[model samples]
Target: MAPMAEPVAAAPAPPHFVIVPLPAQGHTIPMADLARLLAERGARASLVVTPVNAARLRGVAGLAARAKLRLEIVEVPFPADSGLPPGVENVDQITDYGHFLPFFLALKELAGPLEAYLRAQAVRPSCVISDWSNSWTAGVARRVGIPRLFFHGPSCFYSLCDINAATHGLQQQDDTERYLVPGMPVRVEVTMGTRPGFLNSAGFEALKDAAMEAMRTADGAVVNTFTDLEDEFIACYEVALGKPVWTLGPFCLCNRDDDAMASRGNKLGIDQSAVTAWLDAMDTDSVIYVNFGSLARKVPKYLYEVGHGLEDSGKPFVWVVKESEVSTPEVQEWLSALEARAAGRGLVVRGWAPQLAILSHRAVGGFVTHCGWNSLLESVAHGVPVVTWPHFSDQFLNERLAVDVLGVGVPIGVTAPVLLFGDEAMRFGRADVARAVSALMDGGEEADERRRRAKVYGEKARRAMEKGGSSYESLTQLIQSFTLQGGKQH
Candidate 1:
């Protein structure tokens, strides 16, 4: 008999990724989700996070274990030179506004070790997916002969807004004047008063230059938004940046499972079951879910006005309040009064709520949000109409997308430019709040139309995440591109 053919050698694994995320809750969540998506597509993924961030990501590690995916978490010590306090690994921990520079500088200091770690890996990563803010990683990837892709967590529309502003020259625009973005499918207005402070800051200019240079020279960009949601903006961004763009998100939707949902729900320290039970008792589309995100510091007076407004609306609502924000006697008193006035129709959770779980629930009809990208996507994914209250960077632009481009949101009178550090001095009276809530939750022809549009968009978002959908196709193309030639930039 002919000698048995030697066992065929196993083919090598597909492209392995080294994902470096900015150490913040918003950045961390989507970065982790991207890693999971990569693993699902048969790529090995290693997420690099600071030690403190590593601890916060334990839940994700548990998630990977349960799913039995090829994902690993690599701890890279946050630089000692960052001058940050012992336990402060994230931007949110730098309570004092003065520490912002040091935090920015500290992020840069991680580059050396990151390069060293990449060089030492047994199977070198074929691609590096780093936060766009982490501009130094581009050079590191170059040194190691691998392609690097920048990841931006905000909407493509917001990016286009920034690009347009930079192109038109920030010096040419007056602080109070509105200007149209150059390449958008629809006209969107922006003013200096509405732009983020970092856009003009001398120090931020340096970082922005470095990031833009890296982005221009890097392989491509991977944004946490989908094509159907921002097709025009995505195309414009690609033309402006001169690189291939991958829109593989609504990343939150990609990883929605009972276990993943439960794990995320617990992170906010909320009892998921308890929250669901409360929703169970409410009528369909009766409750408005309110959360201003973890970072937006609510002004006490504004918080008080919100309390009175919710009370005036007389509608059932669930408000997610950060425990730290309301710890003061004055805010606590306002919260207590608000609760008393609501007469058992309102529930104020003083910790993290299961945001996705809450949004997906049938009881939640409207979202009163700060217009953060993640919250905006969640609102759209769940078919919940929004009352937009944009108070910071990229939020105002996102609000325009929801209210104008998408036609699924109502504005709540917050239009001033918000500085990065200071609170917005604008106050919404109780009447303003009540009116917005009533228009969203109560019956009205316009509100019904907005809700109908919102539901249609939500169905589109869901379809985009399924096999053969736009988002799924984008992910597949991204993976295939990486495997075949590492990466290609226009």
Candidate 2:
């Protein structure tokens, strides 16, 4: 076995922490963020990962030495019968277009590594921080005699609807009622640029049950969004879980330190130099940088249409289209055309782009995104407006947050013909996309007003993460409460 890992910082030999995050990028990024947070707060943490994903985790751990964090990374070996191909446990392993329930057996295989690590620890952990997907880890946490803290990392409005709809019932046919959920008189339209019309769909039930159980059973539950963004929903979570719902998030702070970056240097082996140089060359608020995140399968046709659409619009762009997400000849044609047509006008990154630097860059005026919580939050935190294309999960709600509540984005609905800002849907359309983007960028009238409002919201989000902010207070209080309970490792 690999040498038993040890913590980085010194703080009374701190509480040992074991974190098992979901395998997807969205899940992994937040999990890494939380691990970094715990480490910085004087916690000694052992973040577990499959051998295949160790590199990815390393990228997250980067070599940071904050005052109180000693973070060690442990890689769990893959079992022979996992059925997944060799080196296929990471997020980039496959592009199957569905939920991954079929791999439960493979997932459960981690119990052995998890159990072994617990047995080997010199100082046992006070608690286990886990993701919703790793429900089976509850068994490991229980057996290890540690209280578990499950992180949901979801937006409030979506999470609340997940819980409430489970009890109050949601109707399938009604769009208006979808917005006006039972007991929520103010129509919790949490997504940007879209209606809450599809909450009753079958996609949300398992997630709700799993998340609800995780919160109910754990000592405490944590979310990545802020209290101001979801006060009502957090209250709902607090009540349902019968435990404090600490909203110590947006979870983007993990990347704030050098250690976080250093940990990943040897792991990802990313070729970021070219992308960085290209981005540096772009004029302020000019390049349309893009990436659909790790899990989003890039449909080539849609990629082509997007390229075509951007080309037709006569704008500069940077589109990242994953090879796995696109597998057609026509898409190749579009890409070929894009290569020739978009020399100065566009640059497609093809894989993951450094999101943080991109968002903060003066060149990126907006984001065209799949509305994952992190990406949406990143855009909001940076005051960059968005073109929201919700693919799944709480994304639909996040789309609403951008388009409706925040006024920083517009919905580019993602059904039938993939809608950019203005294309009409069963309800909304391209005129919408173009107009919205135009307004936010330079369009006069309400356009400037909306951008101004968006900047204010972004500032508020910044405040939540600052000293004495809601998230900061919540974090301090959470640690204090646990400390008061004797700070004992179970």
Candidate 3:
């Protein structure tokens, strides 16, 4: 052998990322998608979740393995005295709003176990990407010497407005006053009634402080949005944070196949095939898809109003009713009667339905949604216009983006936000719901325009994630930075 050729150097291992998501459906779904995206991009990504949350990831785990991606699910023990019942590790699982605080604060307990887990790993993660709510990770990242990137689940518009409103003390103003949010790229108005309940709760002040501190110390931020969707807001947010901000999303697109779409979030209550069959039977762009997100708790009156509104609209529809909302016997009877009256025209799914799959269906013309960021993006990505019905938190701000900025949504005329636990006074009844639904689903010039705009944005969203696209480039830059840092350490 001619002086044996010098052994070739093996390629450096791909950068490894540890992702921690707040244990809620809206937060975890996008984070899980991000984890998949990272693994797909030739990186080793692990998702740290509690045992209960791990169960929700089984489908994701299988899909990743099938694709030969280095995606993993790591389990850390949830604190024992978390004030939540056993196996209740997610925000959606909390029936009583009283446990919300304890559930939120309990996330801090994971920092210690998470740090130990990181130390025990054979290959240290190149970076730790965590949810903004899990602010405790800041200390862990600092102690472990791993760079931390905060992953925000909402839009740049919402984040910027929220920060500005809080900084300007707008939350303390009168509930009816319309105050222009300070320091935003656009003129966004907010009212105290529309602010999140947590903003006024003294019990939640500590958690909020910690989250703010974490943002101040974070290496940067990774948001689940595309620049094409929120270009100006993204630029403003980056400046506000005074750090690098990466926009690499509409992460739902990572779920390429039916298996992935159907299994994207928590386990389904109804069979995916059943949902598909129902949709396939309906006319194209004729069905209204209604969902209030995972955490919203609607009283019986609200549920009845929604049911009556859908029934009165006479449009083919699929409504997802939370199991918690139908606990009372009166509500159950009312639901049964409504189902009987609207058998073929309406389908009501109890508990979690395959939301992604349903929205992607051609039959879905419009969505009556709670204006959750994930739900809004999903609707936009699928070219489905929305009837915005914001609940709380950043939802009101998100509604403004969809209705005012994008012009792809019509508001359902609910002006005030309700507490998650409080007995909410019904503001908009069946008439408001029926009017919004009819305006969106029925053939009207405004409705057609809204649909057209949503379709165009949907196309832009898809293109943003393609190779060499804006989001793709951003993700590539982020990964390269991490890889370089990892190489230096080695």
Candidate 4:
């Protein structure tokens, strides 16, 4: 009787993930959001970043505490000898594009320290979730005998279009030649020059090749997109990538709470309250919202011409100008003049902006965006039409998703894809910007149709994130799969 029964052993906890996103905002934000999503679904999570980035993400600890989620912030010192300026650990910090090569070199040095850190963790990481830029993580994951999942921070449509463009030999076409992306759900046009450099340049090819090779060798991909929005594209992406691809995305929707968002501080320093108040004062669907994301650096002339375009649109607007790019006194003077001329019709946010809040507001009629995946998803989620101004990388392809696949946008005439630090073949003038903005917001059959399609898509996006939705189910499956693998390890 005294030795009746021994206490049953407790079941082990789920997998612990070590997320290593590229230091860029576009990559970091989505990765962070994914971590939050995993934690919400009952998995242990940790994010590794440079000490500088860790400080930026300190608020996350408080966020997790409030949500009662499991998350830890692990910091590794950035290589001090790496030639980059002190505290300059991100791509956005390289004011001169000439330093990009050196910047990449510095990023490569992070792998060693990160690997050592993971090995020393008490609960070994079951997987290494890394951005496409961190190709070296594949090796690290292999060394540690863990799975690696590549993260693509863009739409499935954009990724598939790029894959199809390569498959159809569109990569060889001239700069301005428009060719249909093969095997797409709808007709989308792209030019050879609009493709990312890894496709053409000898030096940059190494990075692309490494990323693709890593994906081929890894467990699978975790794309930042959902099925309902790009069902056809998702199918095509799976076939092209030849791996099990999961379309659990619009990670922005994962954190519906205000506290979660506040945790990711606005790096741009814009006044959130004032911007919202101004937007609140505008009529529904009357004001256009403008932003080029964190990394885009528009030349002074381009900035001035865009200002003129905003003025000429005769529509209420809010524009975010990157602080680093608009440093000169002349540009500042131009911005001051633009704000003064608006006479309360516009708001110019110079530093940081709460982009999600702005997009969801009823007053935001259209988005003039650089076509970053996050911005594109936000615009689509809010059902706001777009005036696409693609700058680099996958942006041009994302523009096609809006203007071509979704029919919810008009291009601002960026025909040739501009490379990082490459010479501009054509400068965007005021006329082009004004016309694109007008086409999106001005009353007309075309604009109305675009608005209708956008609202419908937006509704669908919202539904996909709800309970029992496509994205919701996909996320559950993702966690379960990894958790099982983690259990096997122990």
Best by lDDT: 3
Q: How accurate is candidate 2 locally (lDDT)?
A: 0.64
Clashes of 1: 1
Query: Which whole-number lDDT from 0 to 100 does residue 426 have in model 4?
Result: 57
Between candidates 1 and 3, name the one with more favorable lDDT: 3
Encode model 1's per-residue lDDT on 358-423: one tens digit a residue. 899999999999898888998998899999988877889899999989899999988785544445
TM-score of each: 0.94, 0.83, 0.96, 0.93
lDDT, ranked from best to worst? 3, 1, 4, 2
- What is the Cα-based TM-score of model 3? 0.96
Error of 1 at 85 (Å): 2.6
Per-residue lDDT tens digits for candidate 3, residues 1-490, read 5788899987777999999999999999999999999999998999999999999999999999998999999999899998789988998888786888989888888988899988877767799999988999999989888899999888899888766665665533355577667787777777766653233566888888888889879999999889889999999889888899999988999887889987777778899899999999999999999999998878887788889989888899899988888888889999999999999999999988998899999999999999999999999988899999987888998999999999999999877878774336648888898999999989779999999999999999899999988899899999999887773331
Error of 4 at 486 (Å): 2.8
Q: How far in Å is the alpha carbon of 435 misplaced in model 4?
A: 1.4
| Per-residue lDDT over 1-490 for candidate 2, one digit per residue giving the tens place of the 0 to 100 score | 8997897754454455688886666777777777777777766667788766667665554454334358777888766776665666755565442324434446777888888888776656667888866777787888878788887756766666666655675544455422334544246533223333222234645644555565567877778988766676678767855677779876775466334433431232234555557778877766655666666564443455566666655556667766664456766676777779778767776556667666766777768787888888877777777777676556777666667676777666554222221222333333444444454555466656655765676777788888788987887776665554434442
Candidate 2 weakest ten by summed lDDT: 416-425
Q: Which segments of model 1 are wrong by more than 4 Å?
A: 1-9, 170-176, 196-202, 419-424, 486-490
Candidate 3: lDDT of 392?
81
Report the error of model 2 at residue 402, Å: 2.0
lDDT of each residue in 334-453, candidate 4, tens digit only: 888888999789888887788887888899999999899998998888899999988777888888788878899988888676655332555678889889999999979999999999
